[model samples]
Target chain A: MRFGNKDLARYPFLREALSYVTKNEFKIEDLDNSEFYHLVEKAKRKIEDYVFEGKLAYQIDYNKTHEIIVQEEVIIFLISLLLIKSISIDSVTKKFALFESMRFERYLISDLDNSNQDDKTVKLILYKIFEDLFQTKVDLEVDIFNFYKIKISDYLDHPIAFQEREWNLVNRTVDKGYVYLDGSEIVRLFRNELYLLIIDRIKKMNPEVLPDMIISISDSLKSRWEKMYPPLRAPGHQDILPPCIQHIYNQIDKGENLSHPARVLLGTFLIYTNKSMEEMIDLFKRLPDYNEQITRYQLEHLAGKRGNTKQYFVPSCEKIKLNNLCFETVVCKGISNPTQLIYRKSSK
Target chain B: MTSPTTSSHTSSSSDKLKDSITDSFNYPHSVEDDPNKIWLEKVFRKHYFNSSSEIELDNYVSEHEFGFRLFDGYIRRHLNFKNKRELIASIIKFSPSDIFCSPARYQHPSASMDQKGWIGADLIFDIDGKDLQLDCARIHNMTFCKNCKLIEKEVHTSCSKCNSSMVQIVELPCQNCIRNLKKEVTKLVEVLHDDFGIENNSINIFFSGNNGFHIHVVDESFFNLSSMKRSSLTQYLLGRGYLVDNLGFRIDKSDNITMLPNKIYYNKGWRARLLSRLHLQLKNHRIDDKFMRKITQIKETNKIGISGVINNQIQNISVKIDPNVTIDIHRIFRLAGTINSKSGLVKSRVNNLTTFDPFKESCIREDALVKLDAFVDTKLFFNGTSYKIKTGINNIPEFVAVYIISKGIGDIYIEKLK
Candidate 1:
């Protein structure tokens, strides 16, 4: 690990502590001070208490709290991305890991913003804070810990209720209020390549397995999202999609029913852009055959284009509108799902 | 320890020193003679701890268990962050064994470096009065570090005076390390550029303000890349390799092929490339007045697909909204960052929310939701050690709404269902 100017000046105590540990693993008795020894002792005691409490109840090996702590640490660690600048898309997934932890921090801190600002304002703040941090425009005042509280709540109370497979995520978050992931765990959580592979595998599976396969796939995707952005309560009155889906939503037309596939598409887009709307739109347009006729039609449709009832060869062309402006809509009928359609939109 | 009764109430009190900084008696006090914990805890409690009411006692106890890890990049050379080495040399006089530790998050992948970045150190520090007790409890239950990371090894150098261990390291390179590790940094930058079709001008580097360097490529082209492509860039830079298999458009010998089993496709590669082009076009294409013409043209092209080719260009099914559809102008503007929320609806909401009602602001609904309600309702998750938005009985939404609402594109209202 490297030391920055700030870390060098403010944390000499940390450096000294690190020096002793990596060298010879010392015992509590090795150090001369009792206060420092007591601190460690206390932590071990509480952990033991949790373990004992669980054991007495015939629960799992370690208290779920231990894993929650580990998870919380990872979340804070992810926030360190703020210390670094020039954040790129590759770093975006890792960035979400920080946001995930911040959600947990909020729960720990207790007090969060209680403004009447639109739900989007809250959503925007979450997104903006990350943007500010990545761009080095951080508000030293913006506490990442409190931020996680609202986020975790949002996940738990996600507007779309949890299903059977989401039980693990629900248990981890609802029961412990934290989700654990190490460096590898974080990587695995955000590794979109794996999801793509799973989708590919499902494509090869026989039709009989398709339903279960899709359910399993949705479960895995949801689980990953819960780990990445676990919530404590479902989405509240704010009609805006969760940060996970806002940018990915083709359009936020009123009464648009959100399907799992649509959410996944939105999630994938959000993950790719670090949840930046501008970045997401950019990624959407860059798919291999994204500019082909079929792709254009879909993109136009998402942009709010409506179909031209009079068109013969094209049957009915779609029309989309931005602001008050009305534009022709391009449609892709073959792909029933938004996620696959997004893929089709890009695959020429 | 001296008993509180024996000491001059003001003699060695840290609270007295802090009092001079703030006249208000808002500082948090503990049972200890040493007021450092009290003061730090006071500041932390005010800024971070008070952000939520829903937090369970167990949760609060846990946050205190683990003192947040600090990676502010403010350490001096001739120190290590591994255990208590850095602490003893610079700040605290303690051993690493005294504190419980965990791995840091968002660590730069070694792919960003030529060599494995130096092994770092971790420590517990008191910010806003956090101490061994609260920090220890936090460590016991909380998994996340509000502010913590592994110290880069190369960032710090050995002390000339004592030859003591120094360990704040740089991931990309320190000025000193750069002289030694320029080749690696350059290699990474080149790889990032080549793979993403990004240009050299798009690449920029910055010091992490600590022991590492951050590399950014700002090309819009890269933005058009999908998650898989972006992941590949990360993997490539981190040397993680590529996705051997995934459902996407693969360019085979300059031809496009869609491997999505049940879908029909004409020119797959071309479509993928077009998608990239449109993505760039949208990113650069603003919604300002000047860009409106092009926007209209796009809409037209999208309408009655100009050719069988254009018809095939659009990929996803088109979703249409009612031409009369109107969203809350305030909400939309808030998201867009164009409208100043101060003068409009928020002002009245603020007034109504706060109990100080001398202004008699009428815009605030007695039942209107205020910022504090919003925080408690939605943004409670990120409220850590700082940035607290409190909601008490006095300030209601109707009070503040009088100060802020203005006619915008439209006002988007999210009702709080009691």
Candidate 2:
């Protein structure tokens, strides 16, 4: 069950990996040294890549990948986590978790490649990991996709966590308290568990003691992020908005304080629907924390009339969902954006 | 599930039933004044005392909690027994209106829910006739007014004699509901054996006293499964929440076009069952095997839609078993061979499902002829005897009388000593 240091780097989130990486107690001051700068920069670059490319470009050299690279990768994840926490955007953090989990799974699945490890060795490792992580019983059923027969209870114990009808228990082959599944299903299930594990580590991290260098870098990245995607004005067509947007509008109308992303989603959606600055600001009037000047500035920024005038498109449905904003009304099913919600309702 | 007002049930009867009764009683309307409850208590006490047959006690009876609803009293629970003798002792002591046993075996069976050290529970599937909406209910059910004692042959907003909302709807499940429920059970049992790999012997089917059936899967494999796992099992038999995404089938949502698969991975699971049914539907046409590849699952001519056809197929294959019954680990399930006080009928084990007839098989089997007032006109075939019951006093055997009275559609006709 003991994972080598090289394997630990690939799965730094593993319980065994915690012992190797956390050997020395850390302080905020430790992150400032030149020696740690490369790690911090590498960590920042990973986030930048994920935010822009929508992928984590991480690779594991199964053989001859240096122990130093291993140690570095392990420590970099911790640094990357802190950077994400310091940046403090839920959308970025959530998406990064998904990408990072998939990246980790890619290597974990790669380790089971028959060309790299003998059949016996592959099974021993796979069994150990399965038992260690999920307390599941698995037997290799077919060669391709590392197909295995996993006990039904193990698969169904948290099957709903998948949230997809495909992962529903009714759809799978279950016999003698076991479910037959391919490597991808097993790998994705692992990714879901790992995502939770990573989120937990990220939650425990204190962004308050963040070093000045990390904070400055995060601020610059955040601005670059703001300019990366832009918004613009649209025709003021309808009085009503999509339910998701309407829900937020209603909340603001009732003087409820909108969360940062909630405000962003609402503002951009309003601009796309062609709400004027005065009209948009008027909706914000009942907010408990409402101030006319600040509201005007925020709405103006959203309308792309403020600094760095690269107009932002209304936030995509994916982004809204990641930020937990979309109401996902049935009428707006295929419409990918909130502005489309207007067109959809109008067409109907 | 529908609009606020209850669905209608109508009554049909002949006044000839009134002259037939010499003695009478009513329940559910006035529980304190119910002599029927007293008669039922006597019936249950006599059955348990005389029947020396083995009471079907679940594994670890000492660790199982028991609950009982005593005649004319509130339900009592948190009681445990050491053996069948002790359980029977308690039953005789109470002469309970209903009996229930916990599916879960706990370390401290009598302890509070939180404190009860839960061990494991048998997987159960409850399929109730009441849960099923049958077209035949109108044929066999009626609405009876407790105030005016008026029986309406059909659903009425109010009684004809008095405008009373204090009315009860009663049902005598026709052959259609029974046949439908039996089909559900058959489908469930097949899935348990073929899909779950549970042995046929371990799957015990029981007539759930009244208008339902309780299936207890006593297999050791499922005993340790958590509620979530059991819920998954329920979903499997229920044939729901199956998305074609993982099944290698794709439907373009925007255009509503489905990319039908020529070769479905139908070797096992739901797809296997689907393929079998699809085979039967396509068997008559020889063009199926040739054009089956061509027409495997393409868009049906536009109107009804592909989703509709696929959905109909899925619904046809789905078994109607209650997920709550299986998922609830702490449920107090009714025991077989025990009376469901609601209907005064024993929840007997179905040894041979096809031959199992509840009306003929389930009863107190006493020789006494009891006179009862029929609140509704209904037909009954009991112990090889058939009666076209009318809405009036009628003389019937003790078994049929108890069964009807417990159903809230009849009351004992008490002879006034004039």
Candidate 3:
């Protein structure tokens, strides 16, 4: 059941790379000696050509990195390194290795700036494919939670629960609306050490051949690989709203009578964004039987403009659910409140 | 209470008080002459100056405001030093009644006025014994009404004599008060370690000489937390101004029944705490006799009814912390190993909090003897020994004398036995 020659049949690229590296005795005396580096460079060149050639039949103008192909190469490279015993995994190292791999998978699908719906869909599909192809055999998902001694149900249902554990394991920044899972610093350094050794030998052999952009790109990719999960904002800015907020917005647009919490959430969200009073009044007019005076008073009250002068915070995720208005989508996972979503959206 | 003293004794006592005040106003000549000064010098040299030979002052004490409370009761504030040796030398020279360092980090800790650019500070929690709600029998505690100039024998929020709200509460630390303080300390440690995920080594716990405990979290990650973030954390611990309605619990309007969601059990923070407590009450017979009987009669079948019972007890479970201390980053804390002017004992660190008896452990002046002129009949306990005093000069251990004098019940004079 182990991942070895048997699994290599399904993954031919891994088999070929393993044979080539093993035949060379896996001695990385120079960059040219490393077939893995050549494969990465080739993959990078292919992505760059695909982006520059205008071959993609998409309307998005940004340069599209063929992340799935890059991910497949990365997986194969890592598997070959594992096979050759280049990247050793002890009990402690195994936990971080799994965490890093999961992070990589998560990062690949993470919507980069300017990514459209089609790009996201492709990245998700590729991430799933990569997960099925390698992550399962490695048992990364189970091992990550097991390392923390937390049940998967507890971790998913309450992501903040991880914050109660060790800081080296998980970092929860509720205000930032994200939880960062830390990979082992030792494993990360080891990977970078090996990568730098290859790059160093490459420069020593041919100093003028390496393009400046290529070197910079390689350095950026290396740093990205080292950081398990850096802070990131949601893509598409405010245009991409959480499903619940979008649902409420649509309801208000159609003059539907929203529930009390929904109205409060909408009003608070608008006020938080510094919407004008007139604009808020106009928006509230969408509600059925919405009297201008009552709406103005309520808005003014929530904004702390009324007599009591108490500014109200937006309803949390649980509040939305308690008010029977929660209609969550997959992206809403690990977010606790509507304000967090707005914060993330605005951070973009 | 004895009969009021004669006018002759009162006038003589007043004249003596004036002479003693005038004499105390003169600063000590040298460390050799004063026992308190000698003790401070020896402790500072042994613990701080000698032991910290290799450590640079910039590492721990840099950019921190140094304050000294001299024996004359005048506080020299906003003082700074260039090096640890200089700071230690100044502390030994002054032999201050109390030493304090600002909790806040600053660019120039010594700079006065507009020059001291403020930075961030360590997240600190101060659990004072005076603030704890201890239901113990009152002793020789006293309070003064500022508005009516009436003194009371017991601590009160308002003056009973004049019905004025401007009454000051003077707290005398007792066994019950210290025990209550320990409970708060334990709760704070749990919240910090279990709830906030701060490591044991990262947290530093200290006994504030007279009446409280101070917790300092030196973890670098929290160094940059804004005041707003700290306020949030304080509110979270105090369980005040929290939105408990957002916990996804709903009530059925028709039957007036409450339902607990299955997901709430897995939710973290206060919601998870609520669920677990409820589950414990149901599993064990820890509920009230009436509720236990009702649950037993129902055979644990009605979760809605049980949840309703648990919901009423939510506020009682949350830990109480001093919100102001946590929120104010610029607040100063008593320097460790320095004598508290009130208690005349060093504010020392507790290595193991569970077995720490503050009264015995903080008793530093055990060898010295002191004569205290008691003004009221009071019973005092120290180090498992009890002393009953009746309005006269009583010779006792220096520690007990300091305890009595700190409570404002008596005046103490150190007497060297030849």
Candidate 4:
């Protein structure tokens, strides 16, 4: 999905790329004679550099590349790749300059009293850039203990970030080097890394000068992006969960002791839906013998905090049947797991 | 079923019996021998081709992968035939020492083709004498250390003399072991019928001739169970990884008592089992008087005091089964009519498993009397008779002779009696 009006206003380069790709209409249009010749010459030079001098021989200016190309689809295609990090800037300074040129520095430094620290300021700007580009809203909390390594709390001053929040929200005692982000937030960060690979591939391609070729390439890349990040459901979509998961939710709601497999299935489902560890522990408190410490430990373990830190996926339909916990409804017929069912129902 | 006719006054009757037993043993000599081939051919012809009904035979071989173990310990596997008669003919020709068949069905069982995918597998449970905990006579077994060449009489994982970890334990099942195996078989049958909803007709129980029992479920629904599903079933049967709290008991905060939902008693599998066990425990007056009074007073409400004693009682009831055999779909079980190589007794299928005694029902040649040359002093029980013999030659029934020889404690000798 394309960025909204607010994101466009915040990042002018994206708006400029969008205008260039659509010819001011956000739709493909016939390239002007002069613009077409310029694109052809640029494509020819890129092909020669790639073929003879290798990858380092050619590099596109992230800020000024729109001037060289006039095809609306090609411009949009490249910008989308850049947004996804499929393309990279030559250096960290150049990357910071590109972001600064997009007017990201004003909003980033507006909240901070001291924005002179280059690394921290750049990280904050990058985090905001990712949030705006992906339209993902992250709840920035000042957590004392680190739940996951890379977090906004790690970059922000602890005293300033924790100023008005409750003492419970800020892990005041533990002095872990890194700050905590929700496990699901960490997943979102990793997803951004994947998007960067896609962008890098697009950045390396010698642009096809033909409008038809560029249009088809743009359409294919858009399809790939859609497939890579399927739209996540809103919290309200929990009502549409598969019958087996709904049954588990009902059991947990009633404070009933769940079987090991049942607990695992519920934990996996909640984790996939981006529920925080505390929220999961709260849900588990309904269990008859719920010990808060033990519940938190188990939830953290499922969240990939313990041992090898490998996150587990929900068990397949076959595994559910094996556990004798399959409570299949008509809707579950063609699906293999609860996650698939969730995605299917929510997409519909 | 054949009973030997011998004249009471004949002097050489023992010699004739000995020679007849020896001849029967020599018939299915090896997979390549002509005598074995001819004998197997006759057997297949009689049982398969000339049988009165073909429906039973057709149903038996339709979805099975057959393998034949030669006398030399090499197994000829992945053999499939079009019809029951053809399969029987092939078995007869080969005259394998042990006939084994897979419980799993493949698209092209005998062909190495890409379309060869597993359709499903039969739900098979095996209860072997080797795994049974018996308190009867101890049969001599050997344990050898691979690392240090140390030998021990009893089975052990590590060598005592050299402290080597590479020790292998070999088990020899005696009559007592078979008796214990029968007990496990009974438990399995009860659990299958009561808990699993399997009908009596759908269950096929067979004695493995040497030590164990194989229970095969022929129900159409059970054929397609995945290995993971089968593994879960094994776990349930073995009582290994069950959460006891999931039986639906919750502590009622109002009265500070553990309350059981009424629906649990009405439920079918483990819930019902737990309810019945609770009833038995209370009725038997096993608990202390104070706890008994508490339970009795709250019997109508289905709530009782939460105590450690009650929790332990709930964990005590579960079926014991051999988990590995049930989970493995490709495991080859011995064919019913084939002779067990170790015991020299036929792997017989019993019509009425509950009343079938292994000693009498599993005997291949009941009437043949043989002489056993014992290497050690041993007391043996077989076919309603118990014999205690010092290290010497003793005349016994063929079944007892085979049992002794199978245990590696004695050798059988056949000669013409003067």
Q: Output the lDDT of residue B31, model 2.
A: 59
Per-residue alpha-carbon lDDT of model 1 for A1-348, expressed as tens digits? 333222211111123323433354433233224433333333223222221121111111223354333332322221122211111122222323233333333321221244333434333433343332222121211222121222222222322113212222322211112222222222222222222222233233342222232243334433543453222221221232232233223232211223333433443434432334444434333221123355444434433343532211111112111111122223334433223333554566
Question: Weakest 10 consecutive residues, lDDT, candidate 1 chain B?
Answer: B328-337
Instruction: Give candidates' CA RMSD values in order.
Output: 33.3, 10.3, 16.9, 22.7
Global fold similarity of model 4 (TM-score): 0.45
Ten-residue stretch with the least lDDT total in model 1 chain A:
A314-323
Measured by TM-score, the strongest candidate is 2
Best by DockQ: 2
lDDT of each: 0.26, 0.69, 0.52, 0.52
What is the TM-score of each predicted model, taking all chains together? Answer: 0.17, 0.73, 0.50, 0.45
True contacts kept of 3: 0.00
TM-score of chain B of each: 0.21, 0.84, 0.72, 0.67
- What fraction of native interface contacts does model 4 preserve? 0.00
DockQ winner, 2 or 4:
2
Query: Can you write out model 1's per-residue Cα lDDT over B12-31, one digit (the tens) per residue?
Result: 42322211212112222332
| Candidate 2 per-residue lDDT over residues B142-228, each given as its tens digit | 677888877776555677779998876666776787888898899889888877878999999988878888888887878998877
| Sort by DockQ, top down from the best | 2, 3, 4, 1
Q: Which residue runs does candidate 4 get wrong by more than 4 Å?
A: A1-348, B1-63, B83-93, B112-115, B137-180, B250-265, B280-316, B366-372, B387-398, B412-418
Candidate 3 lDDT tens digits, B169-254 = 55667777777777878877776776666788878877787778878888765676666567656766766543333333343433
In DockQ, how does model 3 score against the reference complex?
0.02
* TM-score attained by model 3: 0.50
